[model samples]
Target chain A: MRNQLRRPLATISVYGINLLHRQNPYVVAWWSAAFPGFGHYLLNQYIRATLLTIVEVIINYLTNINIAIVYSFCGEFDMAKSVVQPRWAIGYIIIYFFIIWDSYRSALVQNKLCHLAQLENERVAAVNLRPLEFQYIEPKKPWLAALYSFFFPGLGQLYNHQFALAFYAMMWWWIYLTLSRAHESVTLMMVGNFQESIAVLHPQWLLFMPSVVGGSTYYAYIMAREHNRLFRIEQRQFLAERYSHSEVRLFPR
Target chain B: MLVIGTFEHSLELEQALSLLEHDGIARKHILVILMDTDPKNPNQFLSKPTDLYPNAIEVGTAFATACAVIGTSVGFKLAWGPIFSGLSAAVGGFIVGFGLYLFVKKGIHKTRSKRLPEICVIVQCTEEQVELVTETLWKFGVLTVGRVKEPSLRA
Candidate 1:
């Protein structure tokens, strides 16, 4: 009688566990807010998210530069007149949709992950079973890894013995920041202030001026966002190290 | 030292204690481990495995509480010097603690514990006879058993 009763109870508990394991929408929401298509990437729909993020970023850059260029040439009042350009309004719409869609996609993915997690938990709980065992090589100290990254981005991953990823992150960011500083300096040397340049430069310089201002602004934004992401990576590393329960053990010779 | 219990908010050491009564776990048994004070555990509650662990409960609670307090105080505290200053301090403290917690939790809790395979067992049962093995190993209270699950994989 006891066994029979327990079996049904266990089944119900398993079901509940499955339900509880569903992915959370909060993560998607957070990611979308953090980076345009980050939520979609989180959901494993990588290609779409990447395309959307890239397109939206490009459009955003163009629009921002256009606004700045117009202001530089004609002042704030002329911003209204500049809207008639071929793709400006359309670009705005695309960027807006991308942001909204990314957020929505993130929510959907979280919900799915949650459900899958619950189902898995329920299946395991139903059986009087133990977790399977195997040898695990714990990563090196997580906090130190993170601290390394914090002081010098990507160094932590190297310390944790992930040399390839460390090298990539470091190389990419180094190139980016260096290039960005160089570009900014050149822009100042060549053009002075955007608004002032519009007043001073001859018609020959005018043609290139718009593209220059626009490119610099967009690149700056991208670099800043990337820097933020790297900083967070460090934070992540430290947390993993301090909180992880992995331990090193010695085997008999 | 074994640390136990966590506050719903990162209050001052004294304030956190005031919120909860002493339960079976003696006050001395539990330490209010501040992430700020301990540079080693900079992001104590934020990352993967630890974020999902049961031990992270207090850290989460503290962060949530801090967010609530700070968010609520945004508009009202702009009036006077003492009130504004006090609120500002509280907000600053909470933000720093909560940011560290969030960063740690998000980074660490990204993986699911069950999906990954990481366990080891070494039991010497060959020498024992069948009856002894069944009795000693299978018995409810015979051999000591332990489990280690990746907290990051948790829901």
Candidate 2:
């Protein structure tokens, strides 16, 4: 008697809540905005919603704090106020929009996924489905290429016999390193350590100057050498191992 | 749990169970292990649990096929750098392979809550849920439903 009455009451409560869920997406969205992922919890998607909330908050907090630190150091409060806070505030707003967009999209996706699962269950019950099947595919070797790229950006690509890619990567790597090195040298020269700048400034021995000539050359060479070593590994792998069909099947034969 | 060997078909599973049954192994003593199936051709199946159970196994041929096709397409597109394209293809292959496995596991866990096994069905639909499924089944009609988890493993 009492048990029967309790059962219907419990069911009614569940139905009432579910009805609320379907009726107002805005309520869910509002809760989510108020407290990261509250909407997801309401929708019964706890994990993804929680992760999104945590990541968004942490990223926002970190970015804001970093910007605040930069302003604090600038010392001029009025200048910092006009420049820093608004810039950071705009960034924060952008981040918030991104988070909102991602959350809304993910939530809708999860809802569809859940509905599909429910339908699948119903179908399984209604029809005779075949047992689950398993098809094997061999693993691909990326470490070779990754390592190759690491040594000599272009060399590894070249060793893989990817002449054009190797050339492009190498050219870009060279350009970046050269520009950075030149910039570093100029900054060092501007520091004006007197005797050190004088030693490098004389044209007669400019080739031997520590600041202008030898500076950044070693670093550039090191970067280039490192990229080369990486490519060597790819060369070795291509020669030594017989890549399985699935591994190279994505390419041609 | 006492994993009844990894077999490709339900009929094979039934056969293995029958062998144990004939050897005086009680029905309660057996656990039908659903090993991870191959990602490419999910129905083709494999016996290696370590390989199959990895978190990255995909369930269909579509993803891998797409990857291979894409690699070939990219290779043709960049005819100037066949070698570099090949390397890219290799990396892409690994990603697609690992991706399939993750996708399937995620799909399974996502859909698990809606399944009958996950419902925690009460034996009498009245008794509190016992820790084991057999106990609940016994309450319904299966008198000899055996314990198949931790205790069965010990035996």
Best by DockQ: 1
Writing each residue's lDDT as its tens digit, candidate 1 over A1-253 gives 2234311211212111111111234544444433455455435354576575565446645555333433434334465355435566576666665666656765565555544433332221212222542211122333354346534555654453334434644664454345333234335435444343223222221222222222222222222222222233233333234324423222212
Alpha carbon deviation, residue A186, candidate 2 (Å): 48
Tell me the TM-score of candidate 2's A chain.
0.26
Model 2 lDDT, full chain set? 0.34
- Misplaced by over 4 Å in model 1 are A1-24, A65-86, A121-175, A182-253, B1-155
True contacts kept of 1: 0.00
- Model 1 residue A168 lDDT? 49
For model 2, state the Cα shift of residue A253 in Å: 62
DockQ versus reference, model 1: 0.03
lDDT of 2 by residue, B6-91 (tens): 22221222333344445444444332322222334221112123333322322222232233323422332343222234335545
* DockQ-derived CAPRI band for the predicted complex in model 1: incorrect
